[model samples]
Target: MSNEPVGVLVIGAGASGAAFAWSIAGAGMSVLCLDQGPWMKQRDYPSNGLDWEERGLGEFATSPNVRGLPADYPVNEQDSDISPLMFNAVGGSTILWAAHFPRLTPKDFRMKSDDGVGADWPIDYQTLEPYFALNDRMMGVSGLSGDPAYPYHEPPLPPLPLGKSGNTLAAGFEKLGWHWWPSDSAILSREYEGREACINLGPCLTGCAQGAKASTDITYWPVAQRKGVKVRSGCRVREITVREDGMADGVLYYDEEGQLQEQKAEIVVLACNGIGTPRLLLNSKSQQHPDGLANSSGLVGKNLMFHPYAMITGIFEEPLHGRRGPVGCSFWSHEFYQTDRSRGFVRGYSFEAIRGLGPAQTALQGMVQGFIPWGEDHHRAFARLYDHTATLLGITEDLPEDTNTVTLDPELKDSHGIPAPKVTYRLSENSRKMLAHAVERATEVLTAAGAVETVAEPLMRGAGWHLMGTARMGRDPKASVVNERGQAHDVKNLFIVDGSVFVTAGGVNPTSTIQAFALYVADSIKKNIETLFDDA
Candidate 1:
């Protein structure tokens, strides 16, 4: 074992980990970032016109972490339907995210106080606001100012070009007398921070070839590396090593070739996404802490929440020119972001009016939706939907529930011989109601916007993209795994800075908020290093 001690050991190179590493390294900490995936470059991204299967390169059926582990999303052999989607790469999920960077509203933090649901966050929106601004600037978010929905923050850069779909949505909002604003996106409209502007490539999901979409590889990770943070890719951290005194010392992981290795550190920060962090803790069973490293509270893997979502598509008579911009370019009304007394649901949803269907995606979508699996009808349906289809994707807030959890499947181990993180999530009744309400409103909005045909795909239980609240941060140590500053309650030198700390799933994409919270936690760690080490 090497005696070299890192000031901070950051696990996972996703949005939170990258931001945390950057902030700490900028503060002159010796940071070592370990990612369970390999680094991918712009050249590795597929060409704009490639088919979906061909374009999903870095995101293929190969497990980047454990060699023979099944892909995150497996294709059902009989039904041929794709399962859950997750990207394994240096940039993590940010490589395939839509880049819709919306700030969490004040109500999101005080959900317990304002509404009778969920736990209140120890920190409020005001405390996190500055960090949000800093994260926005770091990520090069482009947007206009004056969203009455959220507290004021200076716009990082000018808004991206409003394409045909955005324009139509804007018109519909105007007609309905509802407030609408340009969706804040992490894509560069103009070259900012030396990165290039978006060349209007429509597909932002399959990794941004132009370096415009703010993946961590282009944003924080590079800055962190330049600032002396050592990033080691293809290192799958399986367990957090804890001292007898209940302090995190380092981690045990596997190298690219499945060789087991251990790294020591003064402080261990788990910025691995919600699923990975809990799994690491559960795997790290020591004599002092039998359940997990930070499982004294027994809350490390409980209270899982993912924003229940619904997709409502509108088929217009005229071609909407959907393929001219990024998929997450537009916004719908956030008028229902807060809890409405009239609605049975406890929280609300944000409607994002977006353009869909790159030529290949459109063809696949048409086939799945029963427009003839092949032949001329498929081709015609593809062309029509490619140009005429617009969608309103509703990101509804999902209440945290202990039942929806990430637990270790005792029977299922990965290729690394470590048990895989098993997600057992079921949507709450409130979430179901919210999704139903969102679908209805979305259909109304599409119809009002002059859609000749509309189709609504309401998400069932367990169908959500926004993962959060596993190792939640709160005032009560007994009730949460981490404290307000994301410090683990059980392990003095351990921290969890990610969506897992979120108490509630706010009605927005969580990337921006996750990054902001990571930066905030990094600052907290820097300011309280003496206390953290001395107490340990």
Candidate 2:
């Protein structure tokens, strides 16, 4: 059955969806957001369970193919070098992210103009600065001012204390004389806004049971609801429907009970992220727009970026607050974030440190590395590696290439019988060179930090947290799926408010910038509401 039409129907109530719904509703527009996953309760987070680590490695795992829940879809990653990992829940991946918050540098937006590499964004970082600050306050950012890497700005909260791991890494960076700054985390350091402060519980990648992490479910969704927004969970949208006039009608979805229903809307915003957005767009074929909605550019699922990563863990002789930790970045280095012609890569990468690992994860990873064998000396070897390790994650930037893509799998389908998304990605030679450079430098830093030994994984197949550039933004309809305001180039009333609109992938955590884009797009729509559909 068809439901009453809404002013805006937002698919995927994740980071972008939550923020966009809040802003649009504040602008006096009726907003209804739907998500395939259910709203997760803090009490139900894996950290609250007795077998928290077990669940975190399983059902709450980052890979949807491994999670294999009813709400989840299997991503075909066998052919790809790295998996496109994501969460289906309201907060999306933020529920399990390390919360390393950093803004995109000015050069990131003008890559082509400055570095002659990737396409330049329609709007620059200056155009998005105010929105970034607004998002910082909304997301409860914790950071110090005077960061040379970014333009002048202060986070809403103070910086998190750098424990032993952070201090040790800081010394190494100081010795090398590089640019290192305390991480701007989307987590509360001190109690604020009814949320508790972080206790450094370490399993942030699993779930922050303390409610200290700023997942949008707790950050924006409540405010949006108070501002007259409606959110219906467990509604997996099959496809966005179109009217004869070539404007968005709404979407056809499967409700929690698995019943088919249609919801109508005046405007449709896609916040389904890089992979899901393209999957839905390609599934939405009609007589008016045959090559899926807004696919006239033939670039909907092209230019997929995975941010190919490298993990380097140093084994120290002494424990460094390993018992209690912030598994995410304590501080990050931007020394290599800018392009260097001598480095043989157009863009650069960032080094973020992992202070510690959970007992189960450490054991599993140690076993895989043959550091902790199944024999009697396992305890001794485990003790040697336990609290004495510091890992540096190299976030290498993946340039946008049309060869990489997110297409619908012909043979694989979800429980509801919808074709699954297939990821076909290959690491560019530039990225390979960057990873090599990053590994060498990282090894040097670890050595300077007095590490007895170091282990390095040049490329991680599972490190696909930042999925971007699937539906790139551009001024020309023939080049990109969406315009500067995130409006679909083909369908004026349709907008994409997720990472799908990212023109170039930056070498940092993208959640903060993703939220900024959502707020910016929402404001852009409100400002141009009168003329938004005139061109249509």
Candidate 3:
């Protein structure tokens, strides 16, 4: 086999990896991105057909913990209530994401200082603000600027429409004197950059057939590839090899044909989110780093966090026309986002306006949620829940704990004979209290909007989307896996550009901040490529 040295080797072509690679493709450095899954075509997305909901629950489901495809490595989630959801393909989970793009508040970065609950990020929000704008333009975000919930920053496109469901919820919030705004979305509001406007096909979580959703495969990858960034799909990296000088040299991976191959690189960057990043590091054990590379702090697989979610749905007498627009939540309220001493929880949660479910989901949910009966009354119950339901989801801020961790399963291995990631998580007391408060408030809103009946579920199944904080960033090498620049504290040439390095898990969606950090770290790498080994 021919072996050649690569200038930069980025593992995992997800949100962070794609953003970083795209930013540095023109900086006179050869970059190669290796993904474990295949490069999927937009035409082959599940939303192209009538069986979209079935496809979403089956192959295109957000969770690798659920989707169990050949390309997906099984995650052992028997110990956790919230199962980890991730897509192994080129665009990562964005292929199945709802495209809700919300930035972390400035206080999210200074969690330790502001609330004294979790660790503070090595970098601040102001440091990432400009890159947030850069990524917004690249991904084509849609939102209204200058909401009192956050600091002022102009959006690239106008806000996505607030359908009848959103309007109804807004009226309730207005009556209650609470904060609410049209959510920032990765979906296009109008035609831009050769991409078509959203056709509002509903069920955007499965996929977007109109090419309106800004998955990196349709956004950054196209431009990055054109600028000479080489992407190798169907390649699962097994380990990062170390050179004689105790620096990262390259990676060993299993190719499509299941053959072991070694690809050398001067710099090795990991964008494999939280779980995958820790798993790879723990598996890559060597004599110089016997406990796992860059793991001298013993925090590689520690502090695993997933934003605990709660769902509350209301049954209305009138249909809200939820089937006519994007399937994801249309509006959000950050009124309860900050910490308040009287709230009984340190960090707060955000509420989103979720649309009604599809026919199959509606029937299943009705049966499960218990207002709809079985056997004789099933049809009548289903009719009541069909298009007359509105939902609100509360994404709670989960604090980091050493007990909530990702470890290697001793017995389970994947199709490639690699050890599987075992997630062990439990809801904290603070999180439980937050969920209760969110459910109560959501029920009040729905009741204010004239809901005949309401159902609330504090902990929803299959809601773990943002996996973060396994390899945290800090100023001290002994306490953190990476530094402010996402550089591994122990390994000089090894870097991470994903949510794994996040110090805290914010209440809102993390994709926007994940991309912003990727851009910031990419600029840092480009500026410090000559001095990358100076105690990073």
Candidate 4:
């Protein structure tokens, strides 16, 4: 019902949206952010409750495919074995992500040049280096210096203690003569910017009640709000409405009460991740854009990618204190991160040293992996796993394929009566080969570390956390949805700053890169406001 036009209308308050909103709003723009999920207070997080695991199963389930919350739109993944996982909240998936922050290596930007496979990023790492530092300060990252794998950058805080599990894994990498370093994390090691330090409450994925982990709800949103950015929660955007001139005009969304409303804006920016962005565009079909808004290339929903994951566990004879730090990986190896034609995979993978699973998670995973049976032997099998396991997860780089796509479901609809996103993805032969090689290398490292037994799973379903490349960026308008600055090639007033604009999925946790690219786009928009507004 409102007819006021804001300076900028940003959809999705997740990592990319938060960063862009904060950057643009700080420059004194009248920015308004909209998110389908609620703004949960710190006390409302599952970590504050006694039944944390039970809460995870119901309200805070990591995967949208599993949680099926009313706020969450369903994802139809019947054709794909790897299900998409996400959290619908003010902070977006940051609410559920383990705070492990790793920057994409420089080589990742030049995948085509380095490996002769996959598309090269339109912009290189050097162009994004300053933004990476800017985002690091904004997120308050903690890590160690002197990493040979990087181009010399210092983290804000000293690395969080490796603890017993991290030290165990570090020793394994050292023994094998592989390059390893302490992981950079978004969780605070000491109080900074009025946020408290981490108390080592174990799992960072359940949401940090202590305000140590830097979710956008506690970090960028607060700062952006203080800078006069208006964030409206519980509003699900149905479609991006375009003007008669073929430019984005506004968005049609359902309010918390399920009433349709339109908020016009001078510029429309989409930070709705890969799946959400494509789905929204696909659903916005009109006479102007017969396919979808700004979808002239017909590539909006194609090239969906999820980093193929393989988890390997090692059983040690001696007890290792596992429940003392973040459950996301502590130490990581880039030993096999670069392309090696001898390995038979175009791109490479990273080895993340994850902590051993807790009792509940151990039992759950053990049952699924068939390591433990029900009834009589269950207790004994569980006892063996307790405090005696270490895990290494191999994150493989997934190349873009036109077949891996996000389409609109014909029959399935969300609680808001919008068609749900239909995903169809399959592991490429390159990915399968990469997983096989990474598992073998990881097993070797674990065995070298004096493990009595080792168990490895080639691939796990529902490990699709890094949703990327559905609306990729490139110089060729025909090949990409967006330009180098995240501006849609077809619509000058429309921009996208999220994983959806990734040209290539690198072999690392993508949040760091996602935030950095968002900052880059925001800065680009700020610098070119006159040109951007002139087109309108």
Each candidate's TM vs. the true structure? 0.94, 0.99, 0.98, 0.98
lDDT of 4 by residue, 352-461 (tens): 88887667877887898787899999999888888888899999999999999999999999999999999999999999999999899989999888788888989978
Mind giving the per-residue lDDT tens digits that candidate 1 earns over 1-536? 34377888999898999999988996656789888777888876754445544555334322223123232311111211112245667787888788888988888888989998887889888998889999999999998888888787777888887788778767767777777788899999898888999998777777788999999988988888889999888878878887878778888888777789989998899887777778888989998889987888888888877777788888888888887788886775687788897998787999887876666666666776665367657666666676888888888887888877778876677667788777776667787798899898878877788888888778833234466899999878899888899988878788899888888888888888898899999998889777865645
For each candidate, how many residue pairs have backbone atoms clashing (under 3 Å)?
0, 0, 0, 0
Which residue pairs overlap in candidate 4's backbone?
none
lDDT of the candidates, in the order given: 0.79, 0.89, 0.89, 0.89
Q: Model 4, which residues run further than 4 Å from truth?
A: 1-3, 533-536
lDDT of 3 by residue, 393-446 (tens): 999999999999999999888999999899999999999999999999999988
Better of 1 and 3 by lDDT: 3
Model 2: per-residue lDDT, tens digit, 1-536? 33788899999888899988988996766789999998888888887877988998788999998899887988898879998788889888888888999888888998998889889999989888989999999989899999999998999899998899889988898998988999999889989899999998778887789989988899999998989998888989998898988889999999989999899999999999899999999889899889888999999899999888999999999898754755785899999999889987788999997787777778889998889988889899888888889889999888999999999999998888888889899999999999999899999998898888999999998989998999999998998989999999899999998999999998998888889999999999999999998888
RMSD of each: 3.1, 1.1, 1.2, 1.3
User: Comparing 1 and 2 by lDDT, which wins?
Assistant: 2
How well does candidate 3 score on lDDT at residue 249?
94
lDDT of 2 at 526: 95
